[model samples]
Each structure stands twice: as structure tokens, then as C-alpha cells.
Target chain A: MQHKPIHIIIVDDHPMVIEGLKTLLSDDKRVLIKNQFMNGTDTLTYLEHNSADIVLLDVNLPDINGVEMVPKILNIRANIGVIGLSTYSEPSIINQMIKKGVKGYLLKNVTGEELVNAITQVHQGDFYFGSEVQKILADSVTQESNDQPKLTRREKHILTLIAEGKTTNNIAEELFISPLTVETHRRNLMQKLEVPNAASLIKVAVEKHLI
Target chain B: MQHKPIHIIIVDDHPMVIEGLKTLLSDDKRVLIKNQFMNGTDTLTYLEHNSADIVLLDVNLPDINGVEMVPKILNIRANIGVIGLSTYSEPSIINQMIKKGVKGYLLKNVTGEELVNAITQVHQGDFYFGSEVQKILADSVTQESNDQPKLTRREKHILTLIAEGKTTNNIAEELFISPLTVETHRRNLMQKLEVPNAASLIKVAVEKHLI
Candidate 1:
């Protein structure tokens, strides 16, 4: 008895990427290309009626953010495996996608064999991460253990303004918040980031890519 | 009459990258894979005895820095085109490579066709930068035109220290420069960044990725 070929869908904004991936995976007999979509909306629309064994999803999409669309895709068909693909190796984005139920993460430069293996593994309920991705994830874990603070959206907004040397009044006015509230947020940021004052806070924040 | 096929060399540390690129370009009749190397030393050694029309050089190498190796490679064969390939799209790194005489820059995620086009274009003495790379270059130019101050190495060092909330004395001791000299550098940084005070200076520097 022969097993059915794994059907895979490619979703990326770059036509070149779709073409390249298709060409790379064409030689693999175990995999079959179902369709390619240039954005998240088209992929979602197609997936509403159709399904694939795996989805090669680009992290940055034109219409919908790929991470944001992961859950939606799973909602459509929870059994479909997703493997994040992108040029970026940012731990934050990778972790976000993993948290949202992606089965694997691969960089855009992935080898054809690696790509096929990741798709196959994810389809079989195994997790896969490119070597570079694994390194980034490892580094992020270490950084987190070292007390890297996770800032909320509002906190991050205020931090950007603060890094721009905006005064409390300036930030409060720009963000439409009370000066007292801004101060409280500022205090929280400093404490969370483990900085003594504004200067060190900005320095650490920039170093950590918080702004 | 038949023209010579464009001989190309691949110099990337990853075995997968070398194999993937070779596989992708195998079908292209216009190009021939002359050699492959895992590091800069082997590539330089191979180039010293032989020559190729193009070298798909990785920016980061285990033995020698790819950017630093560009001029050396050209020195070996001045007509040979060097294209910097990497996952990074940092404006500073790209500009440095371009300034050092690379004919093109490509992201590692480049499609087989784009890869072929880049090699061919560079071999023909034209320049090529991937779309993402082009955007970065354009953004850098715009930032420069917007009165963005270009800081020297010493100035940037001082600015980082300032952002970290270090005083003149601390910076002076750390850098082995006199307090007066550190103060001068600090003043110069503020003026160049077009900010009136230390806080604003740090803010702008962080915002611009100067730190």
C-alpha cells in the first residue's frame, strides 16, 4: 500500500519566493504543491473551502500578519500544520508564531531537503526549527532568564517617546493620557527593565530592541 | 562561435546552502559551478590559483570576514564580480560592501532565478541589489538627506556611554580619554544629532539605531 503525498500550500507576498519554493520542492515525490497565495486573505479564503497537509507561511504578509493569521487558519482546519517561513530570525516573532500554534519555523533560505523534512515532520506532529531559528530561540530563553522584561503595548509606546527624550508632559499629551498615568507607566518600565533611571532605561531598551 | 559559460564559486559555511545553491543553478546552462568552499580561506586559496566570473560570497565566514575579503578577492582577479550574500540587510553592512567594490548584494532567501540574474548582471559589470536591499539603501540616503548626523567611531562610543547615563568622568576613565576630551565628544554628538540636551541626544540616537 502506498501513502498519499503530503499536500502543501505556499503563502508569501513575493512571487519569486513562491516560484522558488515550488521549483525546489518539485522533485520531492512525497510532497505535492496544492496552490500558492500571495497574501493571508487569499490563503484564508482558499482554506475556507480547501485544505492542505501543510502550509509554508511567510511571517510578514501584505494583507494580514502571518502570526495573526495562524490561529485563524487553525480555526478553519486545526489539523493543517503551519511552518513559518521568512528572512527574519527575530526571536520575538518566532516565539509569537510558536505560541499561536505553528508547528515549525524555517528561514527563507532553507534547503530543499530541509524544507521537505520540516513539512513532513510538522505534518506528522513533530516540531521543527531551522538551526538559526533554534539558536535565536535559545538566545531569547537565556535573555529572558537574565531578566529581559516583556513590555505591554502601551508601555512600549511610552518607552519609545521616552527614548526620544520626550518629557512626561509631552508623552502624556501625545498619547492622550494623564501625566500621572505616564509617570506610573514610566516607573513600571524602569522597574521592569531593571534600570536605575531614564538614561539607562533608554540604553537597555535600545540594546534589547524594545523600541 | 561559443562564449565561455560564466564560472561561479560558492563560499558559504553551511553545507546545505552550498548544496541548495548548486542544485538550484544546476539546470542553468549559462552558468557553471567551478568550485565550492566552506570558509573564506579555502575560497581565497582556490581563487589564488584559479579564477571565476562571479563569486557568491557570504558576508559572514568562519575564517575571514566576507566584506573584508571583497577587496582581497578583487585583488586576486580584478575583473571577477563579487556579490555579498547574507541573511542580514543592515544598511551599514550593505553600504560597506558596496563601498569596498562588490558588484551586487543579495539576501540568502533569493530565488534561483534572482540568484542567476544577480550573478549574470554582476558579471556584466552592472550592479544589483535585492528589493529589500534597495529599500534599505534608499532609506539610508533619505535619512542622510534629512540632516541625520554621521558620527565617528569615537563619537558613537561616547554617545552610547552617555545614553547609558555615564558621566564625563566615567566615560573618560572607561575610554582612557581625558574628562575634557570626553566632554568635547559628548558636545559634538549632541550637536551632530541636532539635539539640545543629553536626554534628547540619546533619544534621537536610539531612534536612529546609532547605538
Candidate 2:
């Protein structure tokens, strides 16, 4: 079960984060702190002549952006598994980092045990996103693909008026249109939005953010 | 200056966080961790008879919310200084914690040095909000008090139309209102929003999230 320790370089702008990670991973003896950097430029410079098994990269760096640093790091050392470390788990940023080729992502509040687990898993060439990250990813997918029903400009205006509890006659008077035309628009809105009545139409419109 | 160690108890559900905190503060002789709890209920029970100078409380607890735990802990021990800790520094949550009588606030990514400073300051009856926290507080203040100009329903609708680059006549045709009435609405939008022209109106409207 024993093997050579996973040499990992910590790339973060915060000194305490590096120290904390070093302290957290120290006792395990499975991962060794090969080096540390305060910014992306220095980390990339260090990586040019040296090599490590993994790079624990931070999202915020003074010299270089974390998302951009991933491909650059891989461009220099393709075998080094890059695990992103950040204080926040923004879905767009995580997705961008993944697209640029990070092996794992972790929130900075990571426990010592999970840090070691992530390092071990990534060292084994398997992708690992922490539980919170996975949850955020799942939430983003559900939220983005929620199928927001589209409505036209006039339909949107009518929807807003309907949400305001306007009668068809009142809406016709306000828009200077015939009451029959207003009722037709209302019926079209219900059909387009797949709702049964005015109440459901307004509810679905709000849910889909059409108004 | 040598003095009696500040007896403190940590309330966090994560064991590794407790261990990491213990490791961080162990080197400092000025503080002593009396005990640790995985939830708020046990911490409160422990404080019923036993006393600690401070409680390093996490925001998320299985049994009790971190903000609610503050007053509860102080109900049992009024003199205990509670320092709120969390992975994220949500402005409203931080503001609520402050309003609830937390003496200090620190992000869980706190450095050992800042952590000791927070404990010492809170122990001495002074407030200590970490630098990142101060920035977020400042941002929330600027964001909330930005003096958003409230617009009525029709005004908001006109604002959206203007943002879509619709001319006064075009909007008049669409809304079935006279061009002169549309012109008055456009001018009213500019004056009410305090912008000089349509471009500025759209810019401010977007900034204020009116459209």
C-alpha cells in the first residue's frame, strides 16, 4: 500500500493558506509539500525548471488569473495534476477552470482529511471535485436547463398587466384595443405558457421570469 | 506580557476544522482551547456549568444556526465573547451576527496570526472584523445605499423599451399610445431617473436593475 509521497506545490496568494495546507497534509506522509508560491507568475516560473506530482492552485492570484494559469501550467508540465483551491465555488469559474484542464476543485474551508483524499485521488489520475463543488455544479445544471418559456414583447406586457390583476376589459381600455383582442391575447398567453387560467399563467410567468 | 491563557471552546461540526484550529492555536501560549463540540446544543450544555472566555463558533451547525447560537450561548454565559466563523462572509449573515452580539467575525480561512488577533481583541472587549470582512461590509454599504431611483410600473415598462433602443414613435406604436404621450413618458423617465438623455437613462436603469 505504501508508495513514494505525492510531491505537491501550493500556489496561493495567502501565506496562511499555504501554511495551513502544509500543516494539514504534513502528518499523512503520503503527500509532501514540494514548494509554495504567493502568486501565479512565480509559481509558473518555478514550474519551468522543476516538477511536482500536483499543483494546488488558488483562484485569486495577484500576478495571474487562476483560470488562465491552468492551461499554462499544463503547457509547461502536462503530467502535473492541477487541483484548484478557492475561497468561493462560483459555477462559471469552476466550469471555466475545468474547461482549461484542472484535475480537481476545492473550497478553501476544506478539512485536512478531505484535502489528503483529493490529493490522493488526483494523484491516481482520477478527477475529484469536493462535495460542495459537486452540489453547486448540480444546482447550476438544474438552474440553467430549467427551460424558461419565452414570450414576445406584447405578450410580456400583457402578462405584466395580468399579473397586476387586470381584467380583459381594463387591459383593452388601457392599451386602446378591443376587449375581444385582449381576451384573445390572454388565451394565447395561456396556451403559449401552458397554463390553465389567469392565476396559473401569472405563476408560471413569474417562475420562468418572463415578467 | 505574560498572562492567564484565554480559555476558549470551538463549536464546529467538522472534526478536521477543529483539529486544524487546534494545531494553529497550539503554538500560541496566550490561548487555551478548553474543549470542542460538533454542534451548538452540546456547546451550550457544556457552558451551563463550565465557563470559557470565548467561543469560536461556526456559522453552519447541524443542531442550531450559527447566528441563533450566539444569543443562546450568551444567554447561558453573558460574559462569553462569541467570534463568528464561516466559510463564506455573506453580508446579511455577517450583519445579522453583528446585530446579535458577536464580538468578532473571521472567515474560516483565517490565518493563525489573524485568528489569535481576533481572539485577543474580542477577549479585551474590542471588535475585530477581518480585512476581507471589512471589504465585504464596505461593499454592502455602498451597494445598498446607492440611492436607487424607484420607478412606477409604466415608467419601468418605458425604461425597458428605451433600453431595447426603441424610438419614441416605435414605442408609441407598440404600446398603442400617442407619440406625444410616449415623448412625455421618455422625458419623465429621464427626469425621474436623473439622467440627461436616453443613453444615460438606459445606463442608470441597467445599473439600478430597473430593466
TM-score per model over all chains? 0.77, 0.62
Clashing pairs in 2: none
Predicted complex 1: CAPRI docking category:
acceptable
Candidate 2 chain B worst ten-residue window by lDDT: B199-208
Q: What are the per-model numbers of colliding residue pairs?
A: 0, 0
Instruction: Give the per-residue lDDT digits (tens) of candidate 1, residues A1-211.
Output: 7779999999876555676687778888889999998889999999999989999998878789887999999999999999998875677778888889999999866888898889889988999998989998999898674334789999998888877768999888998889999999999999998876787887777666677
**Candidate 1 — which pairs collide?**
none
TM-score of 2: 0.62
**Model 2 per-residue lDDT tens digits across residues A62-116:** 7898989999999999999999988766777787788899999998768888999
- The reply for model 1, stretches above 4 Å from the true place, is A12-28, A86-89, A107-117, A130-139, A142-154, A169-184, A203-209, B12-28, B60-63, B86-89, B106-118, B129-139, B145-185, B192-211
TM-score of chain A of each: 0.86, 0.68
- Per-prediction DockQ, in order? 0.27, 0.10
* Number of the top DockQ candidate: 1
